[model samples]
Target: MTSKVDRPPTYEDALQHPKYEPNQLHPGSVESQPPSYSPGSGMYSSSPPSYWAQAGMWSVPDLPPSGMPTAVPTLSGGLPATNPGEMEGSFSSQWETTSVRHSFIRKVYLILAAQLTVTFSVVAVFTFVDPVKMFVIKYPGIYWASLVVYFMVYCILLCCKEPRRRFPWNLVLLGVFTVALSYMSGTISSYYETKAVLLAMGITAVVCVTVTVFCFQTKVDFTSCGGFLCIASILLVIIGAVTAIVLSFHYVPWLHMVYAAIGAIIYTLFLVYNTQLLIGNRELAISPEDYIYGALSLYIDIVHIFLFVLQISGSATE
Candidate 1:
């Protein structure tokens, strides 16, 4: 006995059958066609072809004369429909997330500004005020002592538990740290003439702003090279230490200038790297919750850049 295989109906085959019901195309299909009705039946009494046509299975311009179904039914509810509050809720959530990230960035920058203000204010006092100048000059040991103290407090804050690392406490520790750092900066600034110090400050400001804007607008992401940047920074620090010791012993006239110029370049790269960290989104992003840490990292980068620029310009004048 020979058996015939049933083949699936094509679009042309569906077209040839005018009285075709959708169930006829499927095996064990349960759906049935609507009952016979008079012309008085409302639009709601539409058969499958009329229903699919109105539901936009195929465009009116492209549909055949029979208004044949063009798409397979996939939606459980048939026609696509929007839920009552779904769009509004989705927009609200997106807006809230965007606002939160912006707010976090703003808070971090404001804190950084306040910290800069404190450092510069202290620098001004030590540079201009005779009593403060005389005291720092008379007792040079305070510079190293303040350096040790600042790092001790910095280490404590870094090691603190989550509960202790929140707002006011973190801010307080940061303020103390800024004060300590400024004292060291002020003592260092006292060695240079007033005009040299001001010039260095101007140069530092220009370099910092230029690098910051570049990081913000550039398409080339520096965050990816974070490990390379970190290794470069350590190597620069070692070179700086060796250079400082050598320069202190003998006058290799051009050595200080070369070291200062290289140091400035290294810290400029550091500024870019840390700025990318602050504007967090990349894989190396610092958590938004670590606003204090972000600010602190940026503060150090800016201060180091200032120190290098001061050394370069200050040495030139001398």
Candidate 2:
């Protein structure tokens, strides 16, 4: 009989015959465990790596050693793993915020344009229509009545947030306010000659456009001037009252002209201030949620500017 020779198991045999858990006491398992770097200090372990099984032993896929760090998990190209979704979500959130602000700006301006269109239309009818102009002039009480209505609605919209933000109610209130203000504005415009009114309108348009463009581009933040602007407004009102009282006793043409010029300049500054408030990312900005208030503020600024310009132009022409 020829002597038989034993050979190492093939990869297939290693797979088909994995070591049993109970066979842990076997010398192959004991020897397969890592060795200490030094017999004394177990700081480092040495062994044929766990993936290298002895000739007779078989095993399953190797796991990272309990204490040692294994090959760092990576993407297919060996690049470090990262979360695309998290990065994508961050960008999307920023984009959504920006889009919302832009939409809010558009909504406010659209509402403002509609208001100006309605107001100027009424002014045109009152100025051009002889019968309507004569009738409105005959009944100056109509202007007073509109003033009363405008004052009441303005108070409600400004003093109460709920009325300003409420859906159909807000729109209804705003419409009423717009009509009342339109009548008052028309009455004021009627007091001036047609040429004076037209000239004032042209100048007012140019000034408003220029101020709006400046507010958008200039680094000088007008929003921060709210305190100063408010003070200036109160002082203007006081000076105006004084001027009116003085004129009541004795009309001074130069004083009146000076007052009108001051009013125009002050309200033009107000236009710049209010326009800055409309823009977002400022130290002081109107909230996106209160687009109605934004439009109301801008509309008031424009109307006041127009009236003051009309006063100055009328005085100049006279």
Candidate 3:
């Protein structure tokens, strides 16, 4: 114990000491060794190579190159990239086209209404003018001529590419011709009874309006009735012609009245059927010519109803 504090340890004794042993040092301890410096290298040597630079590849630029603008890829041969604004504009154009189509349909209906008004006014004038003494003709030649002209005009309208353009003029002319012809026909007999004619007209008007309204309101398809009604109509016409031919040998008032009544019923059905077809059948996609055809059908119904009522009433009086 007196000898331990006497002197310092030797180099070999210091190396063998517990403080200088490797097992006693910390796990991550590094030796204090200075790196050797090259003579030519400065304080700031060359920077480490980047990953892409080391691989000899060009790195993408932040922005397009100065003189070389970025090119947008093309689609089909001449088609450009789809822009949202252009797509919206195209949709707007389609909507506008549909609006125009609907507008055209409205105009067509307006024109039809105007034409009907003109026709009715002409008929009214003829009915009220009191031309029984002034415009008498024996053979009803004017009526036949008017019918021929009307049929010709209808054919032209049917065949023409732009029928609407011709419709107004044709309708006006037809109205005038019908009025003139009606006046001529009514004047043929001095025994023209205005009250009876008016009654017939009123009945026809009531029936036509009622049936048309009902058909429109119901919107029921009556196309199925076409075949049956057509066959019946043809039969009625044949019977009427044959009866007229046989009237020389026999006068049958009851038979005539019966025929008239039957004809009236048939015509009533025709009116309802045609109107229902007009209102309900999308397949009917009617044109202006089809409107005229419908008008003609209704007119025929009115005429037949008038004739039947007149005959029935006259026979009853007799």
What total of clashing residue pairs does each candidate reach? 0, 0, 0
Clashes of 3: 0
lDDT of 3 by residue, 1-318 (tens): 436554344445544665333223225656421121223342211222233324433333354434445776676577776789999999999887666545544554454455445554544554466562334334456656766775665565446535524667656544553454344334322233555555656776788788867875764567677789999899899978987877768988888788878888888998777655445344443443355444444554555565677666556555
Per-residue lDDT tens digits of candidate 1, residues 1-318?
423344334444444565433333335646444322223332122244454434434223344635555667667586576675987898999888778777878988998899899888888888888889889999989998999989987887667746235868887788889989999999988887788789888998998889888877887788888788889879888988999899789977588888888888988888888888877655577677888888888898888888888887888898
- Clashing pairs for model 1 are none
The alpha-carbon deviation from the true structure for residue 251 of candidate 3, after best TM-score superposition, in angstroms, is: 2.8
Candidate 1, run of 10 with poorest lDDT: 37-46
Where does the lowest 10-residue lDDT sum fall in candidate 3? Answer: 42-51
Model 2 over residues 37-77: C-alpha lDDT tens digits?
32243223223334333433222334443444567665569
Best-performing candidate as measured by lDDT? 2
Better of 1 and 3 by TM-score: 1
Once superposed on the true structure, which residue ranges of model 1 sit more than 4 Å away at CA? 1-91, 159-164
Error of 3 at 83 (Å): 21
**Model 3 error, position 27 (Å):** 31
